[model samples]
Target: MVKFRNAAAAFKALNGLICVYKPACVPIQQIQHTILTNLCRDLNVLPDRPHEKRVEIVGPTNAPMTVKLVPNYADNPLVCGPRYIKEDFRCSWATHLGLFTSGVLLLGINQGTKLTYLINTARLTRAYKIHGQLGKATDTYFWNGKTVEKSTYGHVTREKIDKVVAHMQAAHQKTMFEMSGVHMESQTMFDLAAQGLIRPANNNLPVIYGIKCVYFNSPNITLEIQAINEYDKYLWTIIHDLGVQLKTSAHCTGVQCIRQGKFDLDIALLRKHWQLEYIIDNMDQCRRLMEEHSLILQPKSAILSV
Candidate 1:
């Protein structure tokens, strides 16, 4: 772990990746602003912050005027302004989560922002544990959205859910090759499929690497999905489509990203811990994880390294 003598040192060392847990129903921009604000606040209050210096005339009207420079309490941060502000730091997020979706969010700070491009280019797969409701459909595909349709869920079973999930995974895997711009009967396509789940070369295309029903009960079902280039609405739509596939209607109740690349929820800091010390620690942890898993920076292969 890196140690700092003062806030100035800490601020300078703050150029790296950090993971944070974003709560549901909160805007991503708000989280970014809050984190940056907290960083500035903590750094400004730390010890060894230099006061603004002012040059004052020492002797007046009597002898030769002498000028001296001294620390001015009036110009101190408490009176003038904080040494750091939200604008001073540049924070960029690798993945974008929707307002209703919460999970592990990866952010790059200062020089770390450049790493985000590599991460995006790598097309890392993300895992989401989505909670969904059966027998109901919403306009926005979320449980909170206005209900548009309702039906009975008694016919749904765990076995049937698994079948549908398997079929969906297979269909997506086939689509992966189709979208890869490779000929369907070519050996290259077969070789790629034999290797395992192949990510789409185009970053804009959404592909589901894997999906399974982790938990199930009447009216409620939980699905754990590993996907690439996906957004909140896309996950919600999966639930809506699953309902259609099961001869019923369903809506998403919640969406939580469990993992992104090697970064997992365990490493994500909560809102309350967004302080300077915690952020620095999180950054170090992320750096080590990346170093250990160098494939995260490699963009050549469509197959992600386990």
Candidate 2:
């Protein structure tokens, strides 16, 4: 573990990766903004005004003191230079989850920002435990998408779902394929669905390299899906087109990161951290694999090294 003397030192020492668990109803950018705000407060890196004075409560025996808490950077040139001060850390995210989809978000700090490209491009797998119903069709291709046709299917069987899933798993390779009458075009699926195409010819299909069915109830399913390409609409498309109704929104339960060759991260971190986990495994490997590797890091002397 890394240690530092003060908040400033700790801030400067914070140069690694971390995962932040995001719950439903919170946007990814909001999470990032919150983290940065808290970190700034912790580091005491807010801009200081020389003329500003704050009231201070003193001990019982002493009088209350009016103190200028922070030194003015304009007067002191050293304070403005490469010291324990920074506007913000270079930040990046590996992947994204929906506003209503709770999942693990990979966060990169400082030098760790260099790792996001590899993590994003790598063939990582995500596990989703979705609570959904079968036999309803929505025009938007998602259960929540403006219910075009409610109560579409009366009853669904495990055998039928298994067959559909098997078909999807096999259909992963097919670039141009149609499930029923819908086309699986990569970019235009959402648009096509939005246009209210009833039993359309063909649309976009995001690539699904593999899918493992963990468990299947009539209206609920737990799946571990692997995809070479990523689009938020892809998973919903598969479920909706398969003629399943969504009882509740789906959420990502776990993610497996495959970097370089083998498994690089432990999935248990999601539960432990509640949604996010910082990953450091194969950092060098990722940096090496990136096409443009430029890390803008402050000098070590700017932070307390002890």
Candidate 3:
């Protein structure tokens, strides 16, 4: 673990990506504010934060004989205000997780803010473990939304669900090539697919590289999906579509992003660890992760290997 002599040193060291596990029902902006507020509070309490220096006039009315520079306790952070505020830090997220979605969220601080753009443009794949409930359909395709319809899920078997998932995956795979902006008949398409998952040239288009049903019980089902440029609604709609394919109704119970590119939930900071020390350590770990996977920083090919 890297140590800092002072708060300033620690603050300065916060110049890379940090992963946090965002809880459900909380807005991303609130999470950002909380993290920044914690950082400011923790940093201000650290040692070596000197009071502001002020020049004290020796002679008052007539003439100033000697002017002595003294530490101004009145202007000290404790007296006036905190030296740092949430606004002092430049923090940005690489991806926008929905208000209802939760899990690994990557944030870039200060100099690392530039890297967020790179990550976005790189079109890195994100893995999600989505939970769905059978016999329910909502207006928004999620559990929180208004229930629009419901149906019997007794006929929905594991084999039926797996078949639907396989069909969905195959359909998305075919669409991936079309959206990739490559000639279907050309050899380039084969070469790219042969290498690995071909990233869509258009970053705005959501592409699902892989999708499979990981867990399945009568009324509950879980899917493991790897996709890029996806939105929360898109993922939720997948559950809705799955229900339709199976001749039943379903709504997404939860959406958890397990991984994004090289960053995974294992290294993500929980709410309790969103302090200065943990943030600095997380930044260091992120730097190491990037070093180990240089392709994350600079992609040599559009193939999504990572």
Ranking by lDDT: 1, 3, 2
Q: Could you tell me the TM-score of candidate 1?
A: 0.90
TM-score of each: 0.90, 0.56, 0.90
Model 2 lDDT tens row, 1-306: 233345554654556556555666678788776666555554554333333334454455566654444534454635454323335677787776676666556667787776566565443445454444454456655555555555534245566666767877776544323442345665545454444322212113244546656676654555556553445555666555555323322322223232212223433134333211122322333344332332222111111011
Q: Tell me how many clashing residue pairs each candidate has.
A: 0, 17, 0
- Checking candidate 1 for backbone clashes, the offending pairs are none
- Model 1 per-residue lDDT tens digits across residues 92-206: 9887899999999989999989887678777678999999999999999998799999999999999999999999988987776777777889998788777766765556678
Measured with C-alpha atoms, the lDDT of residue 217 in candidate 2 is 69
Per-residue lDDT of model 3, residues 178-218, tens digit only: 76667888898888777766875556678887899999987
Model 3's C-alpha root-mean-square deviation from the true structure amounts to 3.1
> Over the full model, what C-alpha lDDT does candidate 1 score relative to the true structure?
0.87
What TM value does model 2 have?
0.56
lDDT of 3: 0.87
Candidate 2 Cα misplacement greater than 4 A, ranges: 1-3, 45-86, 123-127, 152-155, 174-205, 244-306
